[model samples]
Target: METSVLLIEPDPTAAQEITEILQEGGFLPVTRQSFEAVHDSVTDEMPPKAILIGTDNVKESVLSFISELKADPSTQWIPLFILSRTNEDSFRIDCFNAGADEFFLKPIHPKELLARLRGWVNRIGNFEESAFRDPLTKAYNRRYFDLHILLELQKAQKNDYPISVAFIDADKFKSINDNYGHHVGDLVLQGLSKILREKTRTSDLVARYGGEEFVILFPKASGDQAANRIQTILEYVRENPVAEYEGQLRHITFSCGVAEWKPGLSVTEWVKLADDGVYEAKGQGRNRVILSNLQTSEHDHLEEKKKVLIVAGKGMSKSIVCEIDSLAYEIQEWQQGIEEVPPEICIYVIPPTKGFDAGEYEQFRMKHLPKECKTLLLTENHKALDSFQIMATGIDGYLRGPYLPGDIELGLRRLTNLN
Candidate 1:
């Protein structure tokens, strides 16, 4: 069980030497040619546990890249190490500020480097151990799931994708332990784990949250998509008995509550939303898949055509305008001099434009936008909105520019609660 580490180094000689050192340390080192290539590994079945940036060209752009990674929830937790040729105190401080967990000067001591990495990785969790899994079910443990959902949420936010959670609780699970004995209960849990692993996509995560409780993570999936998959699993569980208790076949059924990640929801809030659905499912008579009720109350406007007011200035891309127009929404455009907002407008698409300022935008929002209307801002990545800006301007969320139609769709979904 070797720990996998990523080395992003453009210099072949440096990369090979580092690779040798990593191999000697009993770790697996994967070398990529560029920073962009590192992101390609994010989709890998097993992403590297840590990342090492070894390069001579540690410029401002590199610092910015480090900041981006640290800003991202998913990649931020990975132990990031920067190997630099210069040992200037100011530059070293800059590296640390940009989110490098450890900074080392080049012409490195191999043993020292390996020791530091090992110590850091061990503190995070030795992937070699069963710390990440449940002993009984062999599914990921609650601790692992808790850490994983945060990363998935961050990844989903950065990539403009949806992530969903399903809280599955075994129905009448106490009865199994009470009547059939705990061994049969453990067998039933194992059977459920097997079915979950077999039924889900390899990318999806299945974890035993606790006794008779499990949670599944579905990245790039909407609530409905998660519900459909859970429904299939529910059907399978109902039709096939999990274990035999004495002479009787012990059938099992589970109720699942599914919730999709929303723009501003916290990890606890999101999980609670899904758990609420599970409660609702049990209330409605167990063994069913239920989507969270939060959407039902928040998205009441869905009963009518979603109304959108497009404020695409001259700088706004024509493609973006077309994309918004293509959505199944009642579309209205803001007239150049018009200050009055139309009634029942659910959202406002405000793209970047020259001569526009945040102060003016705030004033416009106050004067024209309805209190319930959610706003999505479009801007370049370099000028991406910060928390202060988002709060000051009263914007719900933003989409980085040079975005595709799919990106627009996802951004809209985030702001408008669209499926």
Candidate 2:
């Protein structure tokens, strides 16, 4: 199907000419005269792929309409272009500030306008696809899983519909990288990804979160149903070879953690719980599935014993030490530039500019931080939060700079309760 374009222009002659030009250029153009008509049309029908507003001589009404469209979620994703009569420098800044995707001069050439419109249409389609797909697996990724699973979780909370998540990790994956080349390991990963895509339903999401780990979001699936699915996949992989490298078959096994979505739990909380279940499976011995809930009090009790380490910088380290000490919990503190003492909770209070190396910190978090331990990163820099979030190396909570002793206590308490 051809892309749709909404052309908003008050001049009848200009609108007719543009409509003819767009149709000839292989687009389906819809013309409207006023902001109210465009608003009504978008509300009653699907939004156009892009909106072209003629700001020929900046009118307050037209500017207001553009602002309104940009603010509305329903129309925010639509690419917007402005046709201006003013000089490029003067209007270019204002047009972009007003959320225009592209700006064109008045007496627009039919060919140039069509080319720009087609370019934007292609860009938007690519953006939408990238937003929901895993970069590595080419499967529906976490963004889609979060949106769709949250909706299902809400329904489960209201109507008692069962929903669960399974966290899967390749057993002894690091050894594979150590024994075979990383290239061979990557081939195994790709083969496993293909098998997962073939086995799962279109409704399910299989996201490759990071190295050797994946999450499956299952809506309307009970704990038993989730475990059964994961078990089937495990058995299939064990029996079927993924890759033949170095004259030997590469077989893969996975450890799975299953947790049913609970009422009044946020999406983040549900994911954490499922991840904890995965840790439990790994602890019990790899290549198994573990489930947790109120009904499984033994599992819950075992989970509480998990430890966390809090690593703090020089300035905030003292504050964290003082706070945790007052709480009557014995915590070992590691000073800046010293070896981090292995603790259940590691608190880093280092300054933003002097953050730890990414690869080193991640190795510490994964190897030193206990399986149950969570890391609380307390820094004064917001940029550090973005960096750690992207790395996703088990830094659970972040506190900005100039924090009070109470803030440190609160962060520790939250992390403790989460564990």
Candidate 3:
């Protein structure tokens, strides 16, 4: 693919010169007249890899535009460069302060400019790739999947496109690890990652979510389509050996669940739906693929399950219940102030709200919760900086809001080891 560079040059002659220079240097230059036109021209589907602003002087307007570009999440990742006639220290400082990744003085040699541009672009690309990839398997890490899924969800919602998620787990992986050793376990993971990368389309993203578990993001694919593809991979895995154990070729199998995006599903909920399919596949005997059968509005609703006590403001409690309902976990809301709840409670969800007191909640948890039970606090997003104070209260985990029920589900699942 040709690398794209967005060039914002007001002077027509300078713009033409820069365009030619970028093209000759092996970049596809996207020229625009003003900063205001950037938003209209650039899109999420095809954002510029880098940006270059060529100007006569570093004006306050340019600084503001730079700040805006850096603030917007979509464009913030692109490397931004400022080219000016003045090499004044103050102008250079101002550009850096406004989030310019690089500053170049005019009359710069074309080779030098291209070198700097290419170097910065490659540096950013390598840094981002390293941050998003799992070191062991070379697959996308959980953090990448978390951010990417949200973006895909937003795009699917806006463009009325289909997006699907496949939650994959190595069938009986624990036995493999116990019997073979961590070395063979690592080999199996690497082999699975290789197979997924080769079998899936370029548009698909393969991510190692956690211990023996992986997820694939299928953009523009429906649940059925994603499942069929996973089925093919499953058959391939069953037929091929992934690793050698004691001079014996050992094969692996995957249990997969596929869930397509719907009109109103949060990131967690969408992933949870796919996860439920994995659970179903495991239940029906592993080494198969299952598509989520539940609707966006319906949760598994298994009332015979253990209980989760939700203690928050009335509105927040109701919202939590609505989100948790899909996971089929029994919910008991105690918005009137968590004075008391049933003895069968396995999880406690308390959000800091109007009547919330961290100290009080801590005391309640200490007095009531068994070793097998865990407490998760819900704090506002801004309160993340004050996490030390929140954690000092001795909660098992804390979730930052604005969050969906699926977020709660994911958190609780992580803490499920407490039992």
Candidate 4:
């Protein structure tokens, strides 16, 4: 592989000469005319193996760049050099103190430059990769993620490939630490790391952003794709508990939010969007993936009300959206399955006229009723013989056929104690 170098030199004449020399020495040089463009160019797929700066004077911008570069643990070890016209004693000392690996007074000398560059490149290549990883979880640390995500966003825009970031926050993590000592919490985190690694693609990145908060970078994936992937992880964790101790099974669940990349958004804004998703998921409940784009439009729904999700057949789930009083609850309709992401009350509409058999409606309700969510049954025909059975199926309330909007609110009030 050709080692890449970030060459920063505003002078085109000097930049071209250095670029050609570096190229001849088997190095791939990515030249940026300004410090601002440097970040736009670097990414996980194209990190510079070394940084080369050419300057006639030590300006504030140059000093700031070097200081910031050294401060970031990700870029700190990559070799840096200052190529200048003056070899003044004070200037040389300042450059060395500012973290430049070497200071050179250059007219031009390709042979000697190549020798030094080669040694720095080799030294960087041999640096322990473990320094970029979180020791306990064995996942890439936040520093690795912070830099790679910025690059991935730039790559996505340039290559016209979709990229997504998912924020995963372990639900009730503090409770786990409190109930089961820190040792078991550590065990659970380790187990979660194993699952995340196993679930993501080899090309994707899995990083422990911080304690109980993880982030995943999905290259060439949309927000929907990221949400689906996280949903799979949610289901797997649900089925398999992370730890078993003292005759009790301990499990950890996470809320995930996925944000797709859009051009012109900064890295901080991109992460904020994904973090908003995680916040929404956790707010709804826990153990679910919520895509920012999937939210109901403000023009169509009300805000700051209890959320009601209706999961039923095609036409059956229709009226609930229109009939729901926005003052009582905010409504979202799902055609196939119940939303595990919190629902204050679920209304399962069963139309007997649609040819669902006598007992089939009860079975359907039993299957789709979310574990913790209160459920209300609105059926057009089950009022006949299934009335007694309906009450016993764990449904909170049942509305007979042809119910009015007033009746809907009444049932909701009864179940949720709004009255």
Worst 10 residues of 4 by lDDT: 294-303
- Residues 185-261, candidate 4: write the lDDT tens digits: 98889889889999999878999999999999999999889889989989999899877777778887899989886
> How does candidate 2 fare on TM-score?
0.48
Where does model 4 exceed 4 Å of error? 1-131, 244-249, 294-419
Checking candidate 1 for backbone clashes, the offending pairs are none
- For every candidate in turn, the CA RMSD to the true structure comes to 10.0, 13.9, 9.5, 24.0
Q: What TM-score does prediction 4 earn? A: 0.45
lDDT of every model, 2 decimals: 0.75, 0.69, 0.75, 0.74
Q: Which ten residues in a row have the lowest lDDT in candidate 2?
A: 299-308
Cα error, residue 20 of model 1, in Å, equals: 6.4
| lDDT tens readout by residue for model 3, 42-130 | 55556788999986634888887886675444466778988888768997898887679888887657898899999988997899789
- Residues 1-419, candidate 2: write the lDDT tens digits: 77678888878888898889899998888898766657655533245888988775446665656655654434656889887666658557766655578888778898898888888888888987887777666766655564445444544554556888988888899999998889888878877888877887765668886788888877678888988888888889999988788798999888888888654344555677889887888899888888866354444433332233445543344435434442424466654466554566667554645654567777766655667666777665566557645356656776785443245556766877732
TM-score for each model: 0.56, 0.48, 0.67, 0.45
Candidate 1 lDDT over residue span 1-419, tens digit each: 89999898888888888899999999999888788767757435588888999756747867877766654444656789998787789888888866799998887789998999999898777553466789888889887786566556656765788899999999999998897789999999998998998999988999998889999999989999999999988888889987776677878899889998775464556788899998999999997999985654565433354667766543243334444442445666677686544634433434333433688777777777778888877664444456687787777777664443245556766766654
Model 2: per-residue Cα lDDT at residue 333: 62
* Residue 122, candidate 2: alpha-carbon lDDT: 88
